[model samples]
Target chain A: MNLAKTALITLCLMGTTGLVHATDPNLARNLAATCANCHGTNGKSLGGIESLAGEPKQKLLQKLADYRSGEKPASVMHQIARGYTDEQLDLITTYFAAQK
Target chain B: MQNRRDFLKTAGIAAAGSSVFGIAGCAGMGKGSGGHVVVVGGGYGGATVAKYLRMWSEGQIRVTLIERNTAFVSCPVSNLVIGGLKTMADITMSYDNLKSRWGVTVITDEVRALDTAKRTLTTTNNGTITYDHVVLSPGIDFMTDSVGGLSGNEALVPHAWKAGPQTVILRTQLESMKDGGIFAIHIPKAPYRCPPGPYERACLVANYLRQAKPKSKVLVLDANGEIQSKKALFTKAFESYKGLIEYRPNNELRSVDAKTRTAELDFDKVKADVLNVIPPMRAGDIAARSGLPLINDRWVDVDWITYEAKGVPGVHVIGDALFPAPTMPKSGHMANQQGKVVAAAIINLLAGEAPNASPVVMNTCYSFVDGKNAMHVASVHQYDAIKKQPMPVAAAGGVSPAANEIEGKFAHAWAQNIWADMLA
Candidate 1:
């Protein structure tokens, strides 16, 4: 990878305060609803796709980071992981993590 | 197949605190709480907004959804129904969950008119409903005038675009067609509901005819210059379904003769045993009727942040009625996303907080090429403050590398999951 790309990835890995923070609950819902297509609605999965409700923030963040990087292999997740900035991903992770 | 051993390890949703995005926090709050929001239509976008508003507000805001039909027949997987892979009952959903689970007052009635200024609406069966805010998710209406001479052809040519009886009409026509007959589908230009849908319909029908009646063929009359969405994947399907699917782009329809089962293209005339034409579409008729500030007298113009109609306070338009943001296709997935955004905005507004300026939106639309094979197109659009549009983030999302049976399974999973989200 180029120096800039490496630096950017490094910044994400280091967990710099979310590149962009979403405070509004609606923002959280809008982002969270997309995952329901595969994960089950409201983060509760009966089977097939994994349920994302009530996950720990750090664990969810790492999984998302893994998907963003090559460590985690997924067709849709990898592409989805790259869509948001470090901050947006962090917000989404935190949102799901807080669900119970 | 992206299989996993752990379900809990993978995913779920968090409902917590500490605002992250800069546009968080409730300001000017306490105005909308205890207020009523009347949402019209109960499709993906409408149903979601009604459900989310109640969820986020925690019973602080009262939501009433008014839809003409008691049950929602999804258009997303309706093609599968026509192809015989699925049935109408499988795709149909009722508002029972919305009423019981979310406490939303689901009213079954057609809206007669909307007085946006007064925040009131009249329904066919039900009496007038006054609200503090109104959300219009009227969905799509065909530009019938776009194709002339289709009046008498109504019974002969079926669009089958909207899910319900028309779907059965087209399916019956296909099933009854002679062994060597031709099935033709006319695709309207872009900005129509579901960009890749027509192409997907062609793929499913072609696959069905391939097995059901090998001697049969599918003819496509597309108005656009080329395949609009998932170009590579659909192009591949077209090649694979060879001898079954024949595509002719730039075949804009000048007129159609249902009795003769023929359409006059720009230059040549084409005929089919059974014809299904998807008419060009615009915002639902109510949007235009209420004078909700349309861009070209068709689509409703709104602030993407809040989904509020321009120049019309307390009115919001979501779903296929709103003009799409840059590169945003009018798919159910996107409509579902928009519903939440608008619901959140309404909730925040009632709380007296400014709506979030920067919001990220995403879409994942799965198109089944056949009963077993499916393809997908995903897009992630971030709110661009300068351009004031939702622009697709580069390299974040894209089409599946190719069509596969695995995604096909996931497509079914997606349909079930989304249905559960909206209805259950």
Candidate 2:
């Protein structure tokens, strides 16, 4: 069997379609919903807080990485950034960066 | 803006659920590859899971939310309504959108029993429903025994913590109070729902009495040694109300004389025309009755990563029903995040993947100092696998430098958007 066909069957058997990303929006949305409590809805903040959306992917990723380390000074991002794996952070940053 | 609806629509993942349910010709509708998840008590946690489970699964895995009430009345900004700042309708939300837009089966009924062995739930309205996974978000119930003479007479001195009829009763009493009358509120200790809530209530009550009946005064009796949250902000707010407000910490309530409106405290006795006593709280009744192992026989004990009740594979507990760790506050925001966290874990397990262990939860509690002015305390907590508790990251949390109207606007937006996320 072809690799594409095997992947398609696996995806179909997993209860999702290829149209949705492997890291689906449901996961992204649920994960991102935590952000809405402070950063407005969907990564956008209305107050003086910096908007997480519409940032460059690399820039966002770098900022989060900085937060994960002791390099950044933050009220809560340091703790928040520590919660995700690098790949998960990649998915999150990509999710928000594409959010314009 | 990439709203949730836009995300679902773009993903072509059962965006408009109306056609999927009422009409036919939809794709696989049974249980999908992922099994069904039954959620009880559609508050902040249950509602979020019910909606997100379907959303992330693309309407594959079925979700049934059993709640006793038809509508959700949020306790987040409920103090405003008690002080006559906002109406009950302002904080009320319905599950209409959860059903119509998200394809969740919301049953308006009380869950009577959870037969974990059979994996079925016996509810008042619905006979019995089986499930693959069950999430319980029963919220808090008062420990009336902690305060004497509180068990039978709830109406006389309303708790008003649950944010509905009691809130109305308190408001009514406050309005009927004569000028120069004393309006007293007794706050429970830490580990209660909304740590900043009582202090915020004191602020609003003081604000109200100062404005409407300048002769009247508010006496805040707190059980804890100091303010549970946002100490600086609340202390400053209390100073703003000066003589109109008097705060006494460590004045634990011993008993109450409902008729005389007197509260017998450890140090002194307080008499008032209006009494709003927030009794000590424990896990909701169902959490105790579900036969789930509870910490100290009060709050449910669960694995921080999965929120699954300890020793019970399929049963998960979230919201204020779970025992609070030192770092975690029982706020609606944290409950909502726990809903998502538990959902994410369940979804992963359903997909035959490992659950996300390192879960990060954030809480932003906005307290309205008055009708328009507000203050906030924000924190980020992560599950520690070693310690098996949620811990705050170093220097990762802070309170607003001062209470202002800008945060008030954010508070409104936060409530609207969170309601939309959970219900809409």
Candidate 3:
């Protein structure tokens, strides 16, 4: 094949793989539901509440652990996180990270 | 700017299958391309080092973290879980994130031995794995023998500091005690993991009993004359609970008779239904067995500037294992900061570049005095190259106000931000 045609084919292949690897929507929805109470809808919160939307997932999990440990004080979030499991934290983090 | 360009160039070549340039760049930057880094004990420091090394190097380094369990149940927040304010599920984390996301090889096995000369680490299950670099962050090993009669028999006198089944056992014992039963918490002198940890435990446990077992009392037996950090603040908060909590200082626990549920303190023998004895500690067994030099009865010695082991070449120690500064209490916050600093040093060493010999490290410790009242201490320090030690940096950070609404809010925000920095 000609060089241009070969390059075009490679570009198309890359796009398809990129689309497949994009964030998962189902995961994002689950996280939104889990975090909505304190973090507000879509992780954007009201006054004094921190936004979790677009934040790194590792940071989210660590913050939750800190709150539960009293290393980080929480008025309500601590109680909220106390109800989550490790699997649930992963699901929540993945879901929120995928949100806009 | 030149260094960034050079790094990008090296990374670009490495990505394009130029193995020679990759090795040359890594070596030039004081890092290794293909050699493995096996970290024993995957807690805050180890996990931070492993994650950052993988992230900052962009998969160039093969990092293997050997932990005894797949999940890390953080001791920082386990108290909340015990107080019924948080659940066990909240404090637990999986190495799966570190493994799958960060490309670190997670070996869920206990480290058995370390051959520093051979550069080999043997695990209980994985046998032996050699490394070009080894990061030991095994944390503290409790010395039950320091508490006299409590030695060897942990079941009778439990120290729930490790945050596992022992934590649950301590919780169960507390739950089973009589409504007005006495709960005795013994605090170690100094150089323990999380200096504010014991006080926080006392507050949370007292908070729990005030509601669940109103008649029960919590007597804190402190080794030091005063509570280590934020003493006055915690003392005042305890008064709000009235008879539920009592603070006793200068009461060093000399021995304990578990059968009689009696503890012999410096002043007298006290009988209690529950005994929580936190003994003196040292670095993990691997550090001692490896023959690494220690400072002030601790783990491998490292120059504060570069975090390189003083006597040992090519070996670096970070976290609770190292005796950096006497005033700096061992906390996850400090360990995470040290991890980044050590990671930078490792990268520099591999590239044949001088590490940032003088890096600033920050530490923030939060202690929840009661359900709502919380106190904090945050500080920044710089390594004095000539002095070979760490000194507090001027005007960087300060402790949380003893009691104020604004300070309370700030402490809460600090916790969120710090956790985000570490895990996220």
Isolated chain B TM-score per model: 0.92, 0.91, 0.89
Candidate 2 residue B48 Cα shift, in angstroms, is: 0.8
* Share of true Cα-Cα contacts across chains kept by each model: 0.39, 0.17, 0.00
Clashes of each: 23, 1, 16
Tens digits of per-residue lDDT for model 1 on B121-212?
A: 98888989998889999999988777877865666899998889889999999999999999999998888899999999999998889888
RMSD of each: 9.7, 7.5, 11.5
Task: Determine which window of 10 residues in candidate 1 chain B has minimal summed lDDT.
Answer: B7-16
Tens-digit lDDT track for model 2 on B62-135? Answer: 89999888899999888888888989999888899889989999899998899999999998878999998999
Question: What class would a CAPRI assessor give candidate 3's docking?
Answer: incorrect
**lDDT at residue A78 of model 2 (Cα atoms):** 68
lDDT of candidates 1 onward, in order? 0.80, 0.78, 0.69
Please give the distance, in angstroms, between residue A21's alpha carbon in candidate 2 and its true position after superposition. 16
Winner of 1 and 2 under DockQ: 1
List the candidate numbers ranked by DockQ, top first. 1, 2, 3
The weakest ten consecutive residues by lDDT in model 1 chain A span A9-18
All candidates: DockQ: 0.21, 0.21, 0.03
TM-score, chain A only, candidate 1, equals: 0.71
The DockQ-derived docking category for candidate 1 is incorrect
What would the per-residue lDDT of candidate 3 be over residues B1-424, giving only the tens digit for each residue? 1344455455444434535422333323333444467777777788877877776566777888888877887787777766767666766767776877888898889878877788888788888898877888888888777787998667867888888877887888888889999999999888678888888888889988988999999999999889887777777777877888888899999999988779899988889999999888888767787788876656568777556567766666788888757466688777777777766556545543445544556565667765666666666565666676777655344455465565445445554444444444
Name the candidate, 1 or 3, with the larger DockQ value.
1
